[model samples]
Target: MIKDMQDLRKLAYNRQLVSNNRLVLPEQVSALESYRVLEKPIYELIIDDLKTTSWTVDELSRRYGIAKEDIREPLLIAMRDPVLVAEGFVPRRVGRAQRNGKGSNVQYTLLPIPIEARIFDITLGLSLLHFDTLLVQHVDQLQFIPHDEGLDAFREIVAEYWSIRGDKVDQFISKQDVNCVLSALGPLFIPNDGGIYDRIRNKLFEEEKLLVPRFTRKKINKDIKKIRRKFSEGFFDLTDVHSTVIALSDLTRFCKYSNRMSEHAELLKISEDFFYSLFIQVHETVPVPASDADALTNDISEVSIGAGQSGTRDKEGTTAMSWEAPKCPVDGTIAEFYTVITSETAKITEKQNALRCLRKHLHAPGVFDLAICSLTTSANTNIQKEAIKLLAQLGDERAVEPLINVYGRVGATLSVEVIHALGSIGSHEAVPFLLEVLDQKRFENRIAAIKALGQIRDPRAVPVLIRCLLEPKGEIQRCATIALGDIGDTVAGPALIKLLHNPRSVIRVEAIRALVKLKYTEAIPVLQQLLGGDRSKAVRDEAVRSLKSLSMV
Candidate 1:
């Protein structure tokens, strides 16, 4: 039997571990024996009072003979933090701390938190359902305080909360589950809850609005389930999983997919480009043996001994003949070692595939680095081609040097692919590299280089083309003159004016067109000389057309 009230109270406090309420084992019981003291009576009184009816801080403190300040902050914090209150706790505020009109003297009333804070609160709990109600209550209440700091704070909180729930929705997907996530995504679009934030969300989700359940869910459950099943069924493996996850991340904000899509996409992009690169670097820096020779020798010897003469018997008591089982060499264990190698390879592959999908979807920076690395490392030319194609699609300036570096390092076919990739990038950075390639003795690389420089359209390329134009080689000079026209820079105007007098009619025609592209009014007098002053009708006609194109009509 319990001796005193304090002892009975101690037993009750120990029994009421609110957070993790599972049956406690003897070890836990022993562990709790030394547990530090907490304000048990005060905590219990508050819980009991909350269960019966909502009570103001003053009323509760008066009822329990405890100070109001002693429980005010703790009660409020407990109600807000899920780890503390879980499902049952509710919080209410007392009469206005200030005296106002008649009804202002009302007792306890539930105080709704700001919608943004509510979104943030729900995010921490991993609950999306509360977002809509919180949004409906707080949308109009949100003040557009026109300060950058205030706006930033508002955007950051909303984005962060949206991002958290978005990720949860993406991690688990079913039509019903997605609908739930989408339904919970209501706060993202509600106006004045942060107008700028709503604009951003709406911009991303506008196209997806036509899909089923509209904005009712966080993500498209169908796509997620399909991708996840493919991953689990071995149809995807890690690479496929990485790619699908990356793709989802990239399209997350825009797709009818889960809210976390953006966060995941952003993460996958970083992992693929930065983390994967670092991982590969780590692997490279740490060497692994290519083969275990000693082990191989032992296995080979064992195999030879075991595989005694095919038809030869063992000795004495044995029958006429018996075949010994062959033993595999230790070196042959490379096949078995493949499992380990494949696992490592799979991890790297998954990281890269995910990055590639993210690069495609998000168009994030450093995507070119991943694509180029993929190209450089791939043994298969087709895979290299694919990487080059992706870099071209990205059309970023960062890709120019890497593509050129690959062209310089690889085989003829891969070199051509890289050159084409540069041409497709269409950035100013590729011009110098392309020009340098034009000076090379090889016809194939030179031709591709010339074609690429012509497509780039940077004025800086004009000097290089003019140098090529002066060369005695007919094809190179001809291509250079034509490229100068495509460059369409006024700087090329004077250079072309000097070229019109050249004996080559092709060069003369190209110069006229180049002048037209540059819109050089200074060349009109020089063109009239070519139009009729003893020049061929082809040159004359080309000059007239050039003049017309320049609006010198």
Candidate 2:
């Protein structure tokens, strides 16, 4: 890694003199001046040691005969500084098992600068030096062209300086080259764009081939069948799942564009099932949201296979397959429902109906396990929600950990469902995770977690709910009040009673109801006062009801 101003200057000088190319810009050099840590001997030593492989702070300290405390801060600063990252000096932080095998130590490993970033650096440098015309003229001759993030930046810079339209540049570049560059960039190139850039980037995404390259229609057809067979046999590798799905999608598009859809009827059926299977596998294995998975499946189908074209093609190319529900067993046993639910070929609605039917057999052998699988694996939000409701209805204590795991990994809507399930299950084991959710800043999640905590009726949540009652937001205070009542912890009685005088009558009403549920007769006198003198009729009505209950108790 280039560690100091001198090294950077030497690099730029050599590139300009020997290669006749300016690879580093003057601004980049100036930016390095602000990061004085680069000039430190320790920083240089650390970079050198990390160049060949990764090393822990302890290992580095031992190698350099310096105190660990002395080098840790500078090392950390270098690891995180954006200037270093942009300039390609920063090392990646990785973890390795400790000598004792207890945990892992953070190890710093130097990585070569990504080719895309390098391309950007070189293109920017050349453009700054008034070589834009030469760069544009010889673009095809350059061994490495920009792609992905660098491609966008390179296009922008070339367009701005060279005055060449981006579309014109695209004509000069082959699709195969673009696919090669994109594949080399890997899935790590996450796009964050807005305005015109967003539109352009999205158009590019739609037009460019995925990591999977195009093959002859014959080869594509063969590969699709092979992939489908592998999926059916449960022998498909999860690591290649994304590429395989994209390849199938590309094949579908090829069939459409080549007017070979009639010849590839089996491809359409296999593609539909394959997409659904991949959706389930993606949800189960990754933390992707249900909506995103839905979009992925929909986008592929709409762009490649065309929507509502899953059946046999008529002479006019309309679907000929009639919609029908899967046949249920005559006995309607739990095994039958499980079979329908777990079947890859079953429609989403059919599987969801199966899950709903399993509600009657909530405690049946293997039912809880099936629900857990659906909760974690089903890509359809409705099905996942149904499974969550079933799990909650089952009230199996063993369901707590799985629910908590799903809660942590899923999107907000499903997370709310998981919270409700945890509360309904009423397992003390879920209390800590629920309490953690309460501490989060998301209003919807916090509110859902609060209500769930109330349903759980865990005493440990009482103090936290009481604290939540003090929050300035009326919705939180109201939910906390109702939750305190559900918990029926006498310890929360005083806090609930205090809300009687709150400015918002809704809070006062909730407090009255909570007090009545807690049977806190001590609030009877206050309730009597509110019943007669409160300004709001709702508060007074609730106060009277509370008083009657408390008095009877």
Candidate 3:
């Protein structure tokens, strides 16, 4: 059971958990856990009712036939919220005592929540699907309001939600969390549902009604501004910065591949350049590592990791990178540890430390091959994990088969890590084995497997991941949708378009992302229907995005 708002707020106010660095709520242990308390159907009812209007505690209980105690927590939750506090007010019973000793004493009326409150209610009620819908439902009303507070609030929500590094948002966890938001917003062209285009047109392109205003440049500039504001907010910290960078890197690719950047190529290029320098500067200013190891950005070992090819080249024919062997570090400690790892006298801790040294100092083939051999011989799980991480970062295809052979023999925890390594390696050679894992693996392992397959960008994996869409697990299905999008395979286009009708809003939203990724212009008519006609506002917003992704092209 979750705590009510007052208790949670009181705890935060008292600085109990606030002593720690990040001031996260108790519920948001993970990004995915945001709004997770609203998973109950009863909470949905309360939110829906609030969205339609607002209700006092007594009225909510009476109207829904639910006890106030039962509804109290969820309702407070809807109000307490994602950064900003809950809106709307419970009217104090003006006169609980009898008036003139006659008939009624007081009335308990619930005033409607402010616009920001409605946005929060819908967002908490819906999940990841709310960003686009929140705007569509309220943009028209925003114009009527006095200031940019509502628009600014919308921007903040977008930054908060998209900036998260979560499974539902990205197929692979980003090496950098910031990049996750970057990637999600990259190819993303959110259809301005409530005539935002009309408003922009009426404002900027008003004089020339006959001509299409060539608004792509304006859109790109707007994106740059929004991203810059998000940066100023400084959403990341040292702990999760890598994940943030990975997501941002993915966004750069996202803009590149979807070719929605066809018109806005400068956006991706400038962002990558700006963020690369900014990250390096921030990286320098941060605390030193426990060991005297090199900073991650300065490490040359990553040079070959994304080598070979980056999915399919966009129309720009982006340059392909060549892999080169890493030079052996001069320290000589790496070679000493490598030799000692297989020695009979070596303890498990020694071997684990050796693997760690190897990861830090050498990416040469001879030493890397030795790491995989440890997987079979070393019973120590810690040793195995370091070896896996080293081999994955080695960016060698040979590491794929050995990792696959060891995957099943290992425990579930290590197996998931193994699959993640395979994905990082980003080799097509791992696709077949990973697809098999999707079929044979259990729980998180299956999701990891699909994620790896997607990163490899092999066409063969497209249909297999699509088949995963039918699986009973909604989690897997969502993973499959994102995987298909990552592959960017044209073959997945029709299949994803078909999912537009899926009753599940998350699935439908993911399908739109996949279709946009594939750039299947053929789906435009269908998307228009959903944009104008879908029952779920969230799903409709996704449709608008898909349409925008194409129309902009």
Candidate lDDT scores, in order, read 0.46, 0.57, 0.51
Worst lDDT run of 10 residues, candidate 2, spans 180-189
Candidate 1: segments with Cα more than 4 A from true spot? 1-370, 501-505, 533-538, 551-553
Q: lDDT tens digits, residues 55-147, model 3? A: 666666666555566556756666433222223332111223344547532222223323322232222211111223444443432212212
Which candidate has the highest TM-score of all? 3
Better of 1 and 2 by lDDT: 2
lDDT of 2: 0.57
If the candidates were sorted by their TM-score against the true structure, best first, what order would they fall in? 3, 2, 1
**lDDT-based ranking, best first?**
2, 3, 1
On residues 191-230, what C-alpha lDDT tens digit does candidate 1 reach at each position?
Answer: 2334433433332222332222322334445554554443
Q: What digit string (tens of lDDT, one per residue) describes model 2 on residues 1-553?
A: 7565555554332221111111233345555423222223455566667767878877876665556775686577665444443334334554553855566566676554433322222222111122223334533532232343234433544354335576655554432233211111111111221122233222212222221233575776587777675444332122233234434444555566667767456666765444333222322334445543332222111112222223355564322332123333344467788787878897555665677778777656767767766765666565677788899899998777666644544554466678788888888878887887776655666788798888888899999999998999887999999999998989998888789889987899999989888889998888877744565657867776777777789
Better candidate number, 1 or 3, judged by TM-score = 3
Give me candidate 2's TM-score against the actual structure: 0.41
Best by lDDT: 2
Q: Candidate 1: deviation at residue 211, Å?
A: 69
